[model samples]
Target: MDVEFLLKMGRTKGLEGVEIYKVETDSLALTISNDKVKEASASKTFSMGVRGYVGKKVAGVSINDENLNAEVAFEKLSSLIKTSIEDPNWVGFPPPRKGFMNIACRDERIVHADYAEVMKAIKELMEIMKDEAVRNGAERASVVEGMVRLGAQKITVANSEGVHTEDECTVSGIFMVLKTVAGRGESDKSFWIVNRRFDFAELEYLGMNTARLSLMFAGAEKIETGEYDLILTPETFAGILASALIPAFSALNILEGRSPLKDKLESMVLDEKVNILDNPGMPFEIGSRGFDDEGMPTSAKVLVRKGVLKEILHNYYTSARMKLETLGNGFRRNPSSPTTPYPTNFHVQPGESRLEDLQQELKKGLIVYETIGQWMSNPYNGNVKATATHALLVENGEVKGPVKGVLITGNVYEWLGSRLRGIGREVFTSEGVATPGLWVEKVRVAGE
Candidate 1:
């Protein structure tokens, strides 16, 4: 709680430095579908993480109890600290920063929005969908969900370097899911809307569209496969791109010699049309936090600016070990998870053309809507072979019908910069990234 206390403990315990971070979260969720309550849930958690550095060796511990044994935490830390080695690359924590983080994420209405009102809204939305002719065929059809997440978090960082920083903020999130049924065909469509400032109305259209799409997906046909150009929707694009970028953002991956982007600075790594940005200050973005886990000023940055390789996210430890300034990327959930580099809000820039405009440019191609086994795609090798599900067979620049059992295989990099034909307009945003559709000139598509 106090810098002096933590510093004294670190010194008396023969530790190099110390840090304590805490998180308390309260969340509420409601689900309604086909005008019935499918699921309703609420959760609350209070957690803290402690990290002690003894030279090059660092260990993290976390506990759910506020009555955490500081002595025990420190004792265990000291034992691990004993294994610490000295590295010349070690730099201490960042200096005390003086500036207030702009508070863009806050809403009193959400904290006050009653459960009864939330349930009513859920039922109302379902009623609207039902009246909208969404019933195709089904043993049952329903809309599911009303949800709210409201919480406050406080993070305090103090180190032997005389740097002390603390931040407090409130956050709220809302999500809805629409479920459709047609005999044995049951599909679920979801839309997540979250921000500190926005109201439930902001989520209405998204939820409705998701429901509409799910209804349209019924009776989808299997695609006859062959090589075809492709247009990737924003959701599909984000799924593929997040996998590719996750490895590039990992310090452990870089240190372990697994990241291909390692030592690839100042190189044109992507298509010139692409701009990847990760910013903590993006307006209304949920992941936008005031400070990184390591107490560095979390701000907007260009990871890939107009196709040139730009920067990597980092925390105090990785920056120190890597001989670079702390980019505030450190993460340690007590012993719950490993500390490593991860992004706050990763995104690719939007293009000029709309989804239809990009589709018009596609003289002939298939639009792969869903993929199976994407998790198995290798980030290191950038190679992916996925079974394309719910693909749209495009001919002469128009979607004919939904086709199943298509496969799209190619290198992620090739799909990013090489085969990149153009980008589309309709940006579907979530979390912190907003991107429209991505159009690639070619991908190996095999089907019959």
Candidate 2:
């Protein structure tokens, strides 16, 4: 799509300001079921989003047509803008900024990957799962279902304030469910691996670990209801951060009186050992980007320092309303969606203790590797509630056995503050947040 032509057309239409966001994507995906290839497909998609401003009112429209009719799109935007309410604090779009950080977010291997290569990779991954299950003494094992997806996308953003930027990225991911039977008991474990570059090593590790865990959890038992020290694995902690903690840092939420951190800036809110950062400049990670959807340059910033609230995320609108500069966190869910304040590559700084060290130090606790319904946790009040679907009991620094059907409930403020025990040194990224295992004390666990 010709963004320049759209901008020129908007000016001719007498719009004071205009913005165009375009995305072109090509993707290939393969699905496996019953240990057989069930589907293999490829797709190409194009979408254009147009935003126009007239006085203090703004409206936007998104179209999925490859050959977009700009006249129709603009007319629709104009009508919407005319009917919308004006914002007295409405500021024009941001101007372009220079010195966008240099980062490599694309991998040629994934961009050039073929169906044959992807199929071969999945086959190898399945073999690894089967072999690892047998090695772990499983009576029978099978890959019930799986999927592999590869995609490359080009994103372009331009506005009338002389802001224009382009970025390209490649993504590869694999998800699988492995079922293992030991004697009369059966266990099913699911695992996923995603990266900007294709990595067979990571896939191999995921398959082996998942199969072993499935076999070990063949006869999982329930635990007694009691307050226990909890060791949340990296993946588990990342999930909680993405769903519960991070949203509380949005400037939009603060301005609208929806965030708990509204009055806690520059105050200690967590443990002194805890620090968090929003870093979009990290190299080769999935969420890394040089500029956000608003065409503003992105840079690393400290959200929390030594447990003190240092900064809150802001997009163009929220920052402008607050009379502050944009932190480049204004992002859109899609081309058609409005911009919001969101974190890009948000992460907790890793500590020096390893997972093993944390387990040994705790002596007795639950190592939670997976959970269900974590998204149901309340971010507004920091009340966390999730079911531990995959957890193991540790006694005397040794993992005794698998435990399931445990309900974990706690408040994030307390868990990260006084109840915090230790943080693992190894960091892992999952569900867009990077974090290490968190050892929290005296969590309320409900079980049999």
Candidate 3:
């Protein structure tokens, strides 16, 4: 389609400015169950999002039909442009930027790896699970669900501001859940791996780690109710901060008076040892990109340095509204939706303490492997409540037995400031965020 023609039509229709975003994706996925390939699939999707600006009344429309020409898309957008309400803070699209950031998130192997290769990896993972069950004292173990997915996406952004840019990214993901029967009990543990690059060695270790944890969880026990220290494993810790606590950092939430950190800029927000970073230029990290959905160059940034709030992610709209500068965190779930601030390759800087050292630091606590209901956390009040399904009891620097149905409740704001202890050395990435074990002084745990 002729992008120039589309912009000209919008101008002819009296729109002051126009922007177009196009995305194309190709993906392949395979699922395995009971050590056998259950399903294999592949797909491709193409979408275009058009934005028209008539003064402050900006309108966005997206079309998924690849057959539609630029003219048809423009006409459809015209029909809906009337419904757009004038925004209080209306600014024109950005002019062409001088330079681009150096981003290394694409991999040649992942871009070319075939479905047969994924199958081979899945099959090998199954064999490792089988051996884990026998070696770890389980009666039987089977892969409840296993999936490997590879995707390639290219996004192109063009506008009247002479901002024309394109970027390509490839992603690799692994998800596995293992069900094991030990004695008279049954347990399961899941693991996730996602990144731009694939290292089979690391993948294999992580794959076996979940099963090993599940096998250990088969030994059940009960603990007395008390205020004990807490050790959150990388998976649970990352999920909590990435999913529940992230909303606290969103400028939209702050603007709506729904974020606890609304008034916490340049202030101490966490323990002095904690450092948080969100950057799009981290090589091979998930969510790293050269340009955001809003056609802005992304770069490395420090959100928190030594427990003090440093910066907040921003989009063009939020920056203009707040009289600030863009940090290149703009993103829209779809082209039709308004762009907002978001994170990229979010992670916590690890400490020098080893896992054993951190464990020994806690006299009595629970090792939380996984939690449920973390997404429902209230960001405005900083309240966090979740059920620790896969947890282990530790006493006197020793791992006792598994414990389940424990409730972890705390105010994330105050907790990160008061109860938060030291971080571990090893960092694990889940989807986009990378985290290590987080040790807290104590948390309210409901146990028997």
Which is the leading candidate under TM-score?
A: 2
lDDT of 2 by residue, 1-448 (tens): 6889999999998899999888898999999897878999999989988888899998889878644777888888889999999988788788887869887789898899999998888888898898899888888889999888889989899999999899998887778999888884998898876767787887788789888878767678999999999999888888787777889999999988888899899999999999999988666677688888888888888999999999999988898898897569988987967788898788899999999888887767899988998999888978899999999899888899999999999988888999999889988875458888899999999999
Error of model 3, residue 431, in angstroms: 2.3
lDDT of 3 by residue, 52-162 (tens): 877678888776765566666667677667777778778878777655777887787777878888778778878897787768888888888888888888888878888
lDDT of 2 at 361: 73
In model 1, the worst 10-residue window by lDDT is 130-139
Clashes of each: 22, 0, 0
Best prediction by lDDT: 2
Instruction: Provide the lDDT at 118 for model 3.
Output: 71
Task: Assess every candidate by TM-score.
Answer: 0.85, 0.96, 0.94
Q: What value of lDDT does candidate 2 attain over all alpha carbons?
A: 0.87
Worst 10 residues of 2 by lDDT: 63-72
Ranking by lDDT: 2, 3, 1
Model 2 regions more than 4 Å off? none
